[model samples]
Every structure is written in structure tokens, then in C-alpha cells.
Target: MIIEGTVLRGPEFDPVEGRVVVEDGAITAIEEESVDSSDIVVPAFVNAHTHIGDSIAKEAGAGLSLDELVAPPDGLKHRLLRAASREEKVEAMRRSIRMMERTGTASFLEFREGGVEGVYALREAAEGLDVDPVILGRETVEAMEAADGFGASGARDGEFSRERNATAREGKIFGIHAGERDPTDINPALDLDPDFLVHVVHPEPLHLDRIEDSEIPVAVCPRSNLVTGVGVPPIRDLHERTTVALGTDNVMLNSPSMFREMEFAAKLADVSARDVLAMATRNGAQIAGLDCGVLAEGRPGKLLVLDGDSDNLAGAQDVVRAVVRRAGAGDVSDVVL
Candidate 1:
């Protein structure tokens, strides 16, 4: 297969008019040429963090605290999940997955709830979908063994030493939530030596230093933080220290669209359009250990083609800025995942 467009090539997303040759699901070569196509071809998005198990409760909790909405156990999200049947949950999740695929997401890193059963449920939900989900199970070591990794709730909630150690022993990814509402949990979460941390919305200078020393990646969910009244992550600071990726967070809080996440991150942070695009694409792919998210040779042929000539994006001056800050699902022409 050959795709000709203004290709956003490599990690820096340098725009070049070219034709990308793909064979057997791998990118073979990118030949620079003056292509006639007005299509924008970039890497398909990799959503670094999500809680898609709560797809049944999209925008359900209005005017609720973060704890009240999603602190686990008896929280509104958990209650709703418990109330919904298995088939209903699976169907809802399937719909969300399909929506993500339609919106140019090639893969997602999911913090699945409900233990081992939860991991299997996500598998069922993702059945027949082209979008790949790297599921990190919560609650138990057995659940981590069943899934891709272990996702901790937060250090304030519990001591995840056992879970972290177990995942490390198994050579699986281990991630934790930290500094979302306050700075108190950041140190403890970092002490676990996790593969990555999610939602550093309140990182202190010391926490930032620790992150810098460890070179840990962070997944920021700005929209979700704003919805919960928690401040957004120090995305510029985090980026300065280590790799930073973008995520949509809970399905109940926001839709799992990398386009929206990228736009929010670009506008909210001091980063440039290219940097935010990397957060939505290559940065997340690095965190998830995926070989996609870049238009380069020897990489997986996962590309998102958008119509630059669309009414919304037509006559745009800056391609990266338009894609990150302005483009939406309606502007997408195709997703070759």
C-alpha cells in the first residue's frame, strides 16, 4: 500500500510532501516528492492513560468531587459499574473503543478496574476492533498476571509495594496515580519506582527533581483534572524533566479522543504544537512500548490521514497547529491502523 500526502515524518513530526510505502503492515520507505494530495498523514494516536471500564457512565457525575466521582470502592463510577450488567458494560466499552478507532486512535493504555475479570472484559470489548489496548489491571497481582501490567489507584489510597514488586518481578509494566489533588502522594508514588506515573497535577519541586533523576514518564489528563476541580499538570515542567504523554483519563469524565487531549494540552501548556503532537503520539507509544506512532521506516504502519482540504481545516497556515489544536473526528479521512 502507498499513501501520498504531507507526511509528518519521524519523532519531530517534520512535514514533508511524500509517498509512504507500506508492505506487510510495516513501513518500508518514505520518498519525498511534491504530492498532489491535500491529505495530512501523521502517526495514529496512542492514548497513554484511560479508565474505559466506566464507559457506561459518561458525563454522569456533575458537580461532584474527585473522591465522590472516582475514588474507587463506593464511588459513583464503581457503583454505576456494579449496577450495569456484564453484557451492558461490554457493549458500552465496545462503543467507546469503536469511537476511539473512528477518531484516529490506534492504541490505548487502559487502567482497567474489576481485577482479572476486568481484564477479560476489556478483551471482550475490544474483540474484532483494530485498535489495540494495553490493559493494566488493578487490585491484585493475579490481575496483573492476567493483563499487560498493574495500575495502582494512588499512594494515598494504599501501599502498593506488593503489587509493584510483583509486577517488577514478572517484568510487566507498573504505573501509579500521583499528585492529582495534592502533593502529599507524589513522593510515595515515586518511591514505588513505577514504570510511569499518571496525573502529576500538584507536583512539588522535590517531586519534580525525583522525576528528573528517575527519568519517569508522566501521563497528563488536563480535561479530567479540570472537570474534577484539580489543577492541570505542570506539563511544561514535566516535559523539561522527562517524557510527557497525553491521556483522556476516565470515560465518565471525558471521551477517549486523542484529538481533544492534544488540543487541550497544546492550548493549556507552554509547549509548541509539535511537542503536543508528540505527546499525543510518540511519547505515549514510548510509554506503552509500542512500535507505532511515527511515520518512519521499519515502524508499524499505523497512520492517520486527515483531509487538510476539509471545511474546518482548509487553508490552514500551520499543519501541526491545525492538527493538534483545531482538527476533530469529523476532519479525519482514514485511520490505517
Candidate 2:
């Protein structure tokens, strides 16, 4: 496969007029030359954190507090999920997955609920789709064993050493939520030595030091925090300390669109457009141990092709900034997954 366009090349996303050669789904080479196409080629997005199981509950609990909306077992989202039939849940999840694929997301790290069955349900929903899901099963060790990893609710919820140890023993990933509502649980969550953490919106000074020392990667979901009335995460600080990735947490709270996530992240943080784009793509891929986020030699040929001449993106002086802060799903011409 040969994809021609203005390729966003390498980690820096340098714009190069080129044609990318793909062999057996891996990028073989990028031949820089003038191409007669007004398409913008970029790495397909990797959403670092998501609770796609809540797809059935989109916009259900408006104006609810953070805990009232999604604080586990008794939250409104849980209630809605419990009320919905398994078939309904599966169908909803499938639609979300398809939307992701159409909008140029190649993969996502899903913090799936409903145990082992939840993992299998998501698999069923994604049956023939190109979008890959790195599912972290919640609730039980068996669920983690059945999926790619374990996703704990938070350190304040329970003692996760057993589950964390079990995941480590099985060579699977272990992740947890921390510092979303406050700084109290950050220490305990960090204590588990998780592979990654989600929603560190309130990391204190000592917590930041610990995170830096541990070198644990963090996946920030700023939109979800804002939706739930929690403060926005210290994205700039987190990025400076560790490998910070971006996620659009909870389909109920926000649309699962990387374009929207990137736009919000770019505007919310003082980081550069290139840095924000990397967080939405490569950093998340690194967190999930995927290798398709950067458009470089030997990497997977997962790419997003956008129409640079589209009404929304035309006349932009900076391609990276336009993609990060202005481009939308309508600008997408093709998703070469």
C-alpha cells in the first residue's frame, strides 16, 4: 500500500511532502517528494483511558456530582448499566467502536466493567471492526486473567495488592484511578505500583514527586473531570514529570472522539500543538504497549487521512496546530487502519 499526502513524519510530526510505502501492514519507508494531493496524513489516535461500557448511559445523569455520576457500584451509570439488557449494552458498545473507527481512532485503552463477561462482551461488540481495544477488566482477578489487564476503581475503594500481584504474576497490565476528586488517595494508588493511572486531576506536590520518582505513566481525562465538576488536571505538570497520555473518559460524560479530546487538551494546557498531538497518539500507545502511534519506519501502517482542503482546515498556516485545535471528524477523508 502506498499512501500519498503531506505525511506528519516522526515523533516531532514534521510535515513532509511524501508517499508512505507499506508492506505487510508495516511502514517500510517514507519517500519525500511533491505529491498531488491536499490530504494530511497523521498517526491514528490511541485513546489512553476510557470506560466504553458506559456507552449505554450517554448524557443520562446531567448536573450530578462526580460521585453521583460514576463512583462505582451504586452510581447512576452503574444503575443504568444494570438496568440495560446485555444485548442492548453490546449494541451500544458496538456503535461507539464504529464511531471511533470512522473518526480515525485506531485503538483505545478501555477500562471495562462487568468482569470477565464484560471483556468478552466488548470483544463481541468489536467483532469485525478495525479499532483495537486494550481491555482492562474490573472487579475480579478472573476478569483480569481473561482480559489484557486489571483496572481498579481507585485506591480508596479497596485493597488491590492481591489483584495487582496477580496481574504482575500473570504478566498482564494493572492500572488504577487516582487523584480525581482529591489528593488523598494518590499515595495509596501509587503504592500499588500500577502500570498506569487515570485522572490525576489533583496531584499534590509530594504526590508529583512520588510520580516522578516512580516514573509511572499517567493517562489524563480532562473532559470527564470537567463534566463531573472536578477540576481540570494539571496536564502540563504531569507531562513534564512523566509520559502523559490523553483519554476521553466515559462515553456517558463525553463523546469518544480523539479530535475533540485533542482540541480540548490543546486549548486547556499550555503545551504546544505537537506535544498535545503526541499525547493523543504516541504517548497513549506507549502506555498501552502498542506500536502504531507514530508514523515512522517499521511501525504499523495505522494512519488517518484528512482532507487538508476541507472548509474547516483550509488556509491553515500550521498543520499540526490545525489538526490539534481545529480539525473535526468531518475533515477525515479516510482511516487507514
Candidate 3:
């Protein structure tokens, strides 16, 4: 398959008029040449963090506190999940997964609720869909062993030493939520030596230093934080210290759309469009150990093609900036996942 367009090539996302040659689902070569196509080609997104299990709870708690909305056992989201049948939960998740695929997301890293059953439910949701899911089970060691990894709620919530150690023993990924509501949980979450930390919305000076020294990657969800009444993450500071990725977080709060996440991050922080694009793409892939997200030779041929001639994107001056700060699902021409 030959996808010709204004290809956003490599990690830099340097626009080049060319055609990407794909052979057996791997990008074989990127031949630079003038193409008569006005489509914009870029890497398919890898959402680094999400709680898609709450798809059944979209906009449920409109004015609830952060904890009241989603702090586990007694949270409204949890309550709704408990009330809904397994079939209802699966259908809702499936719809979200389909929406993600349609909007050019290649994969997502999910912090699934409901233990082992939760992992299997998400699998059922994603079955037969081109979009991939990296499910990190919550609550139990058995759940971690069943899924790809373990996703901890936070250090302030409980001691995840056992869960962390179990994931390590099984050589699976272990991630935790930290510094979202306050700086109190940052140190303890970092102490677990997790593979990644989600929502560093309140990183202190020492926390930043420790992150730089440890080189831990962070998944920032600016929209989710804002919706939950937490302050926006210092995206520039986190990017400066370590690898930073973008995530839509709870489906209850926001749509699982990389375009929206990228745009929000670019405008919220003083970072470049290219940096935000990387956060929406390759940075998240790195967090989940996926080979996709970069448009380069030998990489997986997961690409998003947008109609450059669309009314929403026509005559754009800067390709990268336009994609990051402006493009929407309506502008997408095709998603080759």
C-alpha cells in the first residue's frame, strides 16, 4: 500500500511531500517526491493513560469533587459501574473504542477497573477492532497477572508495594497516579519505581529533580485535571525533565480523542506544537512499549490521513501547528491502523 501526502515524517514531524510505502503492515520506505494529494499524513495516536471503564459514566457527576467523582470504592463512577450490568459496561466500552479508532487513535493505555473481569471485559470491547488497547488492571495482583500490567490508584490511597512487586516479578508494566490533587503523594508514588506516573499536576521542586534524575516518564491529562477542578499540569517543566505523553483520562470527563488532547496541551503550555504532537503520538507508545506512533522506516504502518482540503483545515500555513492546535475528527480522511 502506498499512502501519498504531506507526510509528517519521523519524531520531529517534519513535513515532506512524499509517499509512505507499506509492505505487510510495516513502513518500508518514505520516498520524498511531489505528490498531487492535499491530504495530511501523520502518525496514529497512542493515548498513554485512560480510564475507559467509566464510559458508562460520561458526564455523570457534573459538579463533583475529584475524589467524589473518581476515588475508587465510593466514587460515583464506581457506583455506576457496580449498578450497570456486565453487558452494559462492555457495550459502552466498545462504543468508546470504536470512536477512538474512527478518530485516528491506534492504541490506548487503559487503567481498567474491576480486577480480572475488567481486563477481559475490555478485551471483549476491543475484539475485532483495529485499535489496540494496553490494559493495566487495577485492585489485585491476580488482575495484573491477567492483564498487561498493574495500574495503581495512588500512594496516598494505599501501599502498592505488593502490586508493584508482583508486576516486576512477572516482567509486566507498573504505573501509578501521582501529584494530581496535591504534592503529598508524589514522593511515595515515585518510591515504587513505577514504569510511568500519571497526572503530575502538582510536582514540587524536589519531585522534578527526582524525576529528572530517575528519568521517569509522565502522562499528563490537562483536560481531565481541569474538569476535576485540579490545576493544569506544568507540561513544560515535566517535558524538560523527562518523557511526557498526553492522555484523555476518564471517558466520563472527556472524549478519547488525541486531536483534542493535543490541541489543549499546545495551547495550555508554552511548549511547541511538535512537542505536543510527540506527546500525543510516540511518547505514549514509548510508555507502553509499542512499536507504532513514529512515521519512519521499519515502524508499524499505523497512520492518520487528514483531508487538508477540508474547510476546517484548508490553506493551513504550518502543518504541525495546525494539526496540534486545530485539526478535529471531522477533518480526518482515513485512519490506516
Per-residue alpha-carbon lDDT of candidate 1 for residues 139-246, written as tens digits (9 for 90 to 100): 999999999999999999999999999999999999999999999999999999999999999999999999999999999999999999998899999999999999
**Cα RMSD, each candidate:** 0.7, 0.7, 0.6
Clashing pairs in 3: none
Compute the lDDT of residue 206 as modeled in candidate 1. 93
Off by over 4 Å in 1: none
Candidate 1: Cα lDDT at 116: 96
Q: Which ten residues in a row have the lowest lDDT in candidate 3?
A: 51-60
Q: Name the runs in model 2 displaced over 4 angstroms.
A: none
Clashing pairs in 2: none
